[model samples]
Target: MKTDTLFKRAFNDALLLTSRLRDGDPIPSETTLAAELGVSRTTVRKILQTLTEQGVVAGAGRSRFARASAGEVQPFPEAETVPTSVQVEKQFMEWMLRGDAKAGALINELDLARQFKVATTVIREFLNSFQRFGLIERRPSGGWVLQGFTHSFALELFEIREMFELRSAREFSSLPGTSPLWHELRRLRQEHIELLSEIETRFQDFSDLDSRFHRLVNTAVPNRFIDGFFDIITLIFHYHYQWNKKDERERNEVAIREHLAYIDALLSRSRSAVATACRRHLASARQTLIRSTSDTGSVA
Candidate 1:
């Protein structure tokens, strides 16, 4: 399955490169193509062989040339290129975020597999991994049950989250101007601004953007442990957003503004400013999560 995914991705990339060439343009050499496509020469050779068979390219070895015009070559379908595990994870997260599964809800592997259109084994494995976080548990009768966020869970999670994020934010502020992360940070800041402009109708969109912004901050100083913890953070916050709908638009708007302040602090390269902004935003988020969980009777 891994090899098939790699080949399909490379094949799609080769198709894209081919589409850019004139009908008779010489194909790049195996080494150059491999480097450009980030694949092994063997994979590149396979791609060239397949392209030749499909009449997309002509000739053999170093003598290859394009035979198809830009309009003629078709890339693989987008869905075919994504790994099955990724597809399952995305679908499962979407299911949770859509509030299809409430806190403490029973999770049936067969039902989720059917709902997600994947093998039941896939769902089982995903749940098993997720179970380690204490968010879910196995039942003796069969199936798993969600352990919804409670006030204590919110406090504990935020305690670690704050430590990780503050360290990352400080690291981010000290990044050299040439770092590409600066460019990404700028791009996300603009996205926050745009989302804030349409906050009333686009409020739901903030969940994704919120996740991206924090994830980017952590990239400044990557820690595998922090990275893993973020998976839980992302899921729980997504659940929080879905489960707590009171003043949803207003709440999101405030968060967006706080994010802008945080971004400005990072961009300023002021360590003190970064710390202040980070603390303020995290404090607000902690309170929000605690308040929401406290009000929800479902939490245990």
Candidate 2:
């Protein structure tokens, strides 16, 4: 059988077994269970092992098996995990970081609660912590809003990021311990090029490339703080860089070429060339954004 099919069967069998047994129902013998499920003994063993790990069932000596006790609903099995508040906040945070979270569209404590399937109180506390991180805000209306960055914010972000990259390239290019940052940048730049070639849809593709390229650039920087800059920069770019909607393709290709140049300069240790490339790259985005804003008028 195809691995996909086998895995599906194994999963479905486990789910069926889980549903069939009542709370505290006696577990069946492995052989009987395997035969009944129409699966091989080894497959049954693997399934049972997985169930045991999930806290759904347990066993004892001489092949005895039993249902999970009410207390057995532990933190949750790896497969059936209930995402932590942090994890839920993280999902909401991504949208705030890169999404256009208008007043009506903003994610709040209630949204997080529904999204994570946890209590509203948990989400509220977590969102307050995000506000402390400067990632979100609560409105006077009892609704919460996500604070996004501006174009100037993006410029400052990239500037800080470049400083980190310049230092990392200088240090790691000649060092022995840490991984070469330039190499990773080159790989991601290549991936950006590939994405450009493969995608034809407009904003969505650009959005994806925008995210990936910035991440790649940030990776060149050694500091995590610098890496965090991209998180904010993405929001700024998406909100401000309108680019006439028609220029998306050309804009992306030009970006790809410039990124390639940036990576080349970093690899070759050409500081002047890197600085020049970065300037032109940013200027292009600025020009496009300004043009788009002018076109957009009060519609903005």
Once superposed on the true structure, which residue ranges of model 1 sit more than 4 Å away at CA? Answer: 1-3, 69-71, 132-134, 138-143, 148-156, 170-222, 234-256, 263-273, 284-300
lDDT of 1 by residue, 136-215 (tens): 67889878987645566678889999999999999999999999999999999999999998887999999999999999
For all predicted structures, in order, the TM-scores are: 0.68, 0.48
Candidate that scores best on lDDT: 1
Cα RMSD of all models vs. native, in order, equals: 5.2, 11.4
Report lDDT (Cα) of residue 4, candidate 2: 33
